[model samples]
Target: MSTTTLPDVRVARDEQIAGALALALAASLAVQNAVVIWVGAPSYADPMTEVLAFHADHRSAVAIAVGLEALNLPLLLGLLVCMVGLVERRGGAGAAWSRLAVAAGAVLSAVFALYAVLWIGVVLAADGLTEPTPLLELVWQMHAGAFALVMPALGTTFVAVALATHAGGLTAPWQRWLGLAGGGLLVVAGTACLPIADGSSLLFVGMPGYAAWLVWLIATGVRLVRSAS
Candidate 1:
């Protein structure tokens, strides 16, 4: 007896479409998410802190940002799985186990998103709902878990995956590098929180990286969108 297998063109196309959209969404979301982090991690000692800082004072924005973080996992994972699904259906094409990269990013992004909610909640709910005291609350917030540390790990990992898969694809090498670096910053910024969460110290060291990473991803997404169109 002989077994026959056929390619599901419809499924393949759907996966491609999903992958593209997810990439675009991830890019857009990264920028928005970073803005929220900056806003959420605002310090009281500085004037900018009292102004853009919302975690201690603005529950609504905190909640909104937190909610966005929560969605990171599903969106990332869905994109990754679909991306992988496309790879498999096409052939043993790209890098080995590229899906693992997606998995790393999806899992890590999810974890970070979840903890973002927890951390923000802790900051908002602090008993000493004032300027200086509430500032310390942010410090206590870092130890919540190594979630911050892992997010960057995932971000960088996803960057690698994107590069590997695009080894010869239409994506420009420069764009790929930009994404890889952005993802790296996400992880680095999160990890640096390990030592200091006291007053926005993480912002100085990590925000630039995180911000760059987001911008890079957003740029890549724009390229992808433009290409598709």
Candidate 2:
């Protein structure tokens, strides 16, 4: 293509990337919420029977949640790529923090996505076996462990994002502060998870903090898309 068209093509690609990232972020949030809210997935402390029953009763929802989470993996990667692209375009010292955020986010994405797959197995296999309690407990423990382990990564990603945005003044002051606070809470939740294998009540901090972060993600995505426009 001619030089004139090259820039236009580049702009279109950038917009598409930004839009996809935004949609992905929104989708990830929506899927998780639907699983918990609509499917009535039990709390971490619930007995194995309850967990099994919940999954059995809501097998379809569980399956869909798993699929959505699997889909989220690519979306997460796309968001990270678009974020890096946006940061690099800004041409600031904060690019380092953005890069770190992207790295941590990638890890966070994998951890969550893997856990979702495990849960899918739990849901599918829960009803078939004659004695599934032990298996359910084991899987639940593994899920809890994965959740705990990934918390630090999510925290780091948020904190790095906060730093990058703060340095670049790319977001509102409150939004940056939300990231900092959410990151700290996630780290604390991880630490709390160590002694409390049943899933610390504090680990529930992830729920609200993550919810708030979802809003931030939505806002960020919108900003990115608008800028591309």
Candidate 3:
């Protein structure tokens, strides 16, 4: 009956939207990682002069980093919206998970955006300022601290997404586990910030956890694409 088939049509439509968004999100994540690495960014503890010098010399790289990070914000929001829609449409407690995911994603996006903005400021002032070392150093520390501190928000997002996917059968069990495990690592990275001063070493968890998260995103995107087809 036409009535009976209506639900199927709607479900298919949701899958198509979710799939497209997921794929875009995956690409954005990959581009961000590539740009960051290509820029040869300095560490959190690196001297302010060293940091400014790097950006000043490699202005183009700085621009690329800023652009890619900013670009990821919208892509991330879109991805979360699509995923939440899919979960809500499936009808259940998954809605709760979806809400949590959105909240966490929003926080993560904001933090990343702030970090990107600081980098933008750094680039803009790199050539102009003679006594910018103190200011630059302060911004550097803030940016690094923000980056490390935001891991928990991202971890929460991952966990909520994993729950939603499990409930909606959106991804495989192993993939869900991968997400959970990655999230746990992020939590560890956040906790590693306890001493604050020694926080740079804690970044080890962030680097590996982020890589894992990216892998999970790629896998999820593949599934979404397959479903759409």
Candidate 4:
């Protein structure tokens, strides 16, 4: 009896940790967006001069946003690993989907890391520069392109995980549909990544989808914690 109870306790603890990580990641992403908005970060379509000025004026805010992203990366990985564990333990039909989710999520995390690094490079290049040099513009462009490319990875992870969770009986039908729809939008945006990197308005297509994902994360985290309790 003691041995059985010990394993149960451990499982519960793991679930709680996973839930917490999900919530933390959502919060971190929300905060990073807030920082970007607060600092009035320029769009890729904005003139190079405007982009340089924004970076120059809001170095501290950009730094904070980057720091949050750094925190978010590990939280994302932790949550993904935990979700995979849950799916494998209870997933019957979902095993394949979970594997796909983990693979896509790993790519998403890697791309996001690259995005963050590119932003860091942009900031460094903009430092002490009165005008936007060609090199600075180039780095900034690379950053924008990296961000645009992240959409596909994010969409794949979102869709795969939603299907896996649903197959494992961890999510409702509505939740699964929501993930599919939202993830689809992101993928659509990814299809036009080249234009988006040039500052195309199509980037907005992924915003709502990403918001849906955040809502899903919050709801899923709550459910996981409740179940553990």
What clash count goes with each model? 2, 0, 0, 0
- Provide the overall lDDT of each model, using Cα atoms, as 2-decimal numbers: 0.56, 0.73, 0.76, 0.87
lDDT tens string, model 2, 92-180? 75889988988998889988976786777687668765454776777777777777877878888888887786676556678788888
Please say which candidate is ahead in TM-score: 1 or 2: 2
Q: Which structure among the candidates has the greatest lDDT?
A: 4
Q: Write the per-residue lDDT of candidate 3 for residues 1-229, one digit (tens) a residue.
A: 3564777777777777777766777787777667767877777666666777787788887777677777778877887888888887777647788789999999998888877787777777667665557666666666676777678778888888888887878888887788788888897887765444333677777666677778777778788777766
- How would you encode candidate 4's per-residue C-alpha lDDT over 82-180 as one tens digit per residue? 878888777366878888888998899899989999999999999999998999988987898898889889998999988988887777788899889
Question: Candidates' TM-scores?
Answer: 0.67, 0.86, 0.89, 0.95
Q: Tell me, what's the RMSD of every candidate?
A: 5.7, 3.1, 2.5, 1.7
The CA lDDT at 77 in model 3 is: 83
Looking at candidate 2, what is the lDDT of residue 207? 61
Is 1 or 2 the stronger prediction by lDDT? 2
Model 4 worst lDDT run, 10 consecutive residues: 1-10
lDDT of the structure predicted as candidate 2 = 0.73
Segments of candidate 4 deviating more than 4 angstroms: 1-4
| Model 2 alpha-carbon drift over 4 Å, by segment | 1-16, 129-132
**lDDT pick, better of 3 and 4:** 4
State the displacement of the C-alpha of residue 79, model 4, in Å, after optimal TM-score superposition. Answer: 0.8
Ranking by lDDT: 4, 3, 2, 1
